[model samples]
Target chain A: MDIQFEPLQKRRLDQAKWAYTTRRINRDQNFQLLGGTLIPKAGDLVLARVDELGQHQRLELVTSRRASLYEEDEIVVVYGNRYAPDQFEGIVPDHLEPCRLVAAGGVAARLLNRHDRVKTATRITPLGLLADDKGYRINLSSARLPKAEQIDHKPLVLVVAGTSMNSGKTTACANLVKGFVRQGIKVAAAKFTGTGAGADYRALVDAGADPVFDFVDAGYVSTYRVHRDVLLDIVMTLGAEMSSNKPDVIVIEVADGLLQRETARLFAIPEFTDWIDGVVFAANDALGAQAGVSWLSARQLPVFAITGVLTASPLAQREAHDICGLPVYHTNALAQKSVSSYVYSCLKFRSQKQSISNPVREEVG
Target chain B: MTDTPQPGKIHCRTIEGMSQTNYFVYIPSETTDQRRIFYTVHGISRNAEEHIHGFIAQAERYGAIIVAPLFLKENFPHYQQLGSSATLERADMAFDHVLQDVHEWLKIPPSPMHMFGFSGGGQFLHRYAMFNPKRVARMVLAAPGWYTFPDPGQKYPYGIKSTLEWPNLKFSMEKFLQIPTLVLTGDEDDQRDKDLNKTRKIDCFQGLNRIERAERWTAAARALGRAYNIPTDFKMESIPNASHAYESYLAHPPFAQQIFDFLFEAQN
Candidate 1:
C-alpha cells in the first residue's frame, strides 16, 4: 500500500507533540508511514490521536516543556511499560490498537492497573508507526547515544536510592549536584531507571549538573519490566557515556525504592555494585531508613548517609541517627559545601578501599 | 652569573574573588599567540616577588606566562600539603581561585597548567597534582621539606588519602603518574633544620633530609606508575654546588634553567 507522502500530510508530524522519549528520533528519515497488522515493540515510535483526556491532560515535549492535550490532537510517543505504584501500572500492547497515554512523558501502554485515587488514563488511538524510507519502523534503540564497549576512566559515581516513590530521590540528587557544584567540583548526573520524563532531567540541569542523562538516552521509555541483563547494559552504556564527559564526579538516581523490581535487580548485580562508588539511601521515616540501610549492608554495598523527606523532621532525623549509625543530613544540608566535601571525602575513601579489594592485575616484568 | 636582561613585566594584583590573598603574573615582553602558562608556587617564606624575578628570564625565553601566588601565613598557614588541618581553607582552592582570575584577566582559553614549586610550595604542588591530576600538564619539585608518599595506607599530607577538609580529592595514581615530573634537590641540602618536618613516622616512611625525601618520593611515584602499567616520566636531578635555600639555587643559573627545560620539553 502506497501510504500518503504528501507535504501537507507530513505537516501532521510537525503539528504533533513529540514526547520526551522520542526526542532522539530523527524525523528527517521518517519518509514512510506504516500501520495495521504490525505488532508494536517497546521503544517503537507510535503516532496516535487523543480520543479523550483524563489523568494526563498534557504531554511533555522534546524541548523539556509540556504541551496541553486537546481532543483529536495527534502525538508521537514511544510504546513502553510503566511502573508507578502511586499512579498507573502499564504494559506495552502487542498489537497496534487503541491504548492509553500511561505517562505524560509520551508513553502508550495498555493499562494493566492504577491506583484508586487517579481518574482513568487519557485515551489515545494508535494511528500508525513512523517508518524509514525502506518501510522499516523506527525504534528508540536506533537513536540511542553511541554504545561504549568499555570505560577507560571512570569518574567517582554516587548512587541515590530511596525506600519508595515520593521519598525525594530526585530532590536529594539535585541538592547533591548543587553541593558538588558549589564546591567547584565538575559534576555530571544521570537517572539510571525511570519512566521517560523531563522533570527529573530539568531538575538536575537547574541544579548545575552538566551533561545530565537518563535511560531514555539509552533507548528505553521506561525501565519497568526491562530484563535484568538489558537493564545492566543500559547502566553500563550510560555510565560509559557519562565517564567520557570526564566530570570529577557523577550523581546517579535510581527511581522507586530498593524493593522495586528493576532497582532490586540492579543492586543485586555485582557489575552495578562494583561500578558505583557509594550509595546514599533516602527514606520516608526512621524505620524505612533502617530497613534500606540493612538491606544494602546485607549485600555489602557501601551506604554512606541517610537523606530524603524524613530529614525534614528533626525527631525523625534523630530517630534515624539513633537507629542507624550513619549521619542523617537534610537535603538543604546536602547542598552545603561543607556537607558535600564530607560526603565526597567519604565516597573517595570507600572507592579507594573497594579498588584495593578488587585490585587490578599488575603486569610483571 | 652575568647580569641577564629581564624580558618580562610583572603584574602584582589581588585575586578577583579572593581578595585576602594576592598573586604575581609575569608576562613576556615579546608575546606569542600560543604562549603557554607556567605556575610557580613559593615556600613558607611567601617570597612571591623573588619567584617572579627568578623565572622572568625563563618566561621570556619560552614566551610563557608565569603566575606566582602568595599564600599568607595568617590566611593559609597550612598552604603546603594543601590543608593539613581541618579548619584551614585549602591552598589548592586558593591556587585555583588565582588561576580563575588569570583566565578572566588574561582572556586565555582553558588549558592544563605547568607547575613549579619550592620547599613548602613543592609539598603543595605534588599534593595538588595528586588530587586533580588532569589539571596539571607538567610539574617540577625543588627541595620540598617533606613529601606525601604514594602509599594509600597512610593519611593525607603523609600519603594518598582523602580527607574532609579538601572538597576535590579524587586521586587516581594511573592519571597522576601520567604527568611528567621533575624532582630537584641540592647535593649539600641534607642538613635537618626547623623548616624540615621532623617526625619519627616521617623519618621512617620518607627520609631524614630533603634530598633523601626527593629520591624516595620519586622512586615511589615511579613504582606506582609501574604497578598501574603506566609509563611515568619522572626524573630526579641534584644541583652540584647548591643548598636548601631558593636564593642559593637561584644564584646557580643552571638550576633555574633545568626547571624551565623540563616544563617546556614537550613543546620542543
Candidate 2:
C-alpha cells in the first residue's frame, strides 16, 4: 500500500477550529506538518479530529468564544496536562495515538482519573503536529510573551486563593476587579496558576480588568506538575509585564486551593510570598475559611480579608469573622465602590507597612 | 570706617523645565565653603518674596542659601496636598526637581537641606518629609491648615497610609521621626476661616483650627518617635498675639529666633 502525502495549506489550517491554548501561535508560521514518529511535548501544537463527544461538547476558540464540537471535526489543540479534581486528571500522552480532551480550553492528554460525577473525557485522534517550514514543531512555548525588564516602580500584588476548585475564587476575583474598576482605579489581573482556560480570563475582562492574563499566556497549557522555578519565572515574567502597564495594583488569582501541591509550594517560597503584598483567601465554609486563614498566617502571609462562598451565608460569615478576625465579604459585595476602596486602602497600607526600610539616622546641626 | 557687605540680593531664577513661574534664591554675602540650603515654601498666598525676605536674617546668620519656589496657583493649585492627578502635577516631584536644579545651579552638591513651610508651605513640607524623609535635615511647619498624621489607621492626606495615585509613596516612621521637627502656630491662630480645611474628616481627626492641628500632630509624631525608640526633637511653639498672617508672626519675638535655633543652633 502506498502512503499518500497531504501538504498543509493556509486554508486547510484556518478551517480547523483553533483552541485558546494555541491562540498565541502565529498562524502564518504553521506551514508544514509533522506526525506519526514525533513524540508530543507539553504545549506542542496538535491538529486532531474529534473522535467522540462526551463531557465537553464545545471547544473554547482562539477568539475567546465557545464553538460546538462535532465528531470528526478537525481541531487544533495543545498537548498538555490537566488537574481538576472536580472534573478530570490527565497528562500529556507520549505518542501520536488517541488522547482525551481534558479541558475545554483545548488540552489533549491521556486520562488518568476522573471525579465520580464527571463523564469520560471527549476523545481526539492526533492527525499530526503543526510545524514550521523548517519542520520545527510549532509549540505554544515559542509564542509566549517575552519577559519584560524589571520594573523599579513595583505594583501591589494581591493574591486571591481558595480552599479548592469551585470555592468561588474566580467569582471573588472578578468582583474585586469590578469593584476596583468602579472606583476608577486601573487594575490588572492574572491567573497565576491553572489549566489553560478562557473562563477566568473572560470573566476578568468582562469585569473591566485590562491586560488580563493566564498560565497559557505564560506559555503553559497547564501548570500542574510543572517545575517550581518555571512557575516562579512565570510569575516574575508576568509580573514585570503587568507592572510595565503601571496598574495601581495587580490582583493574581492562584487556582485550586491552598492545599494544592503547586499553591502549597508557592506559598512556602519567600521569593513568592515576599513579592506578594497581601492575600484574599476564598473558602466554601466557616471551618475552611478558618483553616485557610491559619495556614496563610503560619506562612507569615498577610491575608487581608475572607471572601468566597462562605460570604453567601450570614451565619458562615459571622462564624468565619469571629475566629479569623478578618472581614468576611460577599464576593458580590466586592463590586461596591466602598468595599473596593476599603480593600484597596488595606492593601496599600499593608504594602507600605511591610516595605518600611531600616532607619539610618543622620545628624542635623 | 566700616562697610556693610552689600545686603544680600535676592536673585530671581526661572530654571528652564522647573516651572513657568520664577523661584527666588538669596545668597548671603558672608558665604561658607559648605553652605547649607534653606528652602522656605510659601502658603496658598504664593508669597515667595515674603518668605525670602522673612528668612533672610536667619539665612545670613547661618550663612545659608535660601530658596523660595513660587508654586503659582495656576501651575500648582494643589501643591500643598502634593496632588498627583491628571491636571495637577505632583508638587513633591516638581519641588524635588526644583531643589535639584537649584543645587546644581548653585554649584553645590546635593545634601540634606533644612526646610521651613509657612501655611500652605507647611502642608507641603511635612508631607514632603514623609515621602522623602532622607532629603530633610530639619523641618519647621508653621501654621499648616491640617496635617497628615503619623497614624497608619487613616488613609493618605489624613494619615501616613499610601494611596493608589501615589503608589510609590513610602513613609518609614522610624526614619522620618529621626528628622528634628518644630511645629509653630500663633496663640490667636485658632480661626476656622475659609482658608482652613474644615472637612468633617479633617476636623474630626485633626483639630478644627490651625493651633490644635499643630499641637495634635506634634504630640502624635513624638509618640510615634518614642514608640520607635528614636530620640525625637519634635517641638511646638505658640507665638503670642500672632494671627494666621505669616508676615506678622515671622517678626514676632522669639518666632524667627526659635526657627533659627531649632534649624541651625540645635545640638545633635
Cα lDDT tens digits, model 2, A1-365, are 22223469888888899998888888865467676666789999889999999899999998879999999999999999888989999998878889999999999999999999988999999998887777777888888888643444467788999999999999999999999899899989999888988888899999998889887887888888888886777776677778778898888999999888988877876556777777888999999998998998888787868889987786787578667756567788788765677677667766676667512111100
Give candidate 1's error at residue A92 in angstroms: 0.5
Clashes of 1: 0
- In candidate 2, how many Å is residue A226 off? 0.3
**DockQ of every model listed?**
0.01, 0.02
lDDT of 2 by residue, B76-120 (tens): 788888875523567777776777777667667555878899999
Tens-digit lDDT track for model 1 on B193-219? 788889998886677899878876887
lDDT of 1 by residue, A186-211 (tens): 99999999799888999999999998
Candidate 1 chain B lowest-lDDT run of ten: B1-10
Once fitted onto the true fold, the runs of candidate 2 whose alpha carbons sit more than 4 angstroms away are A1-6, A148-151, A357-365, B1-268
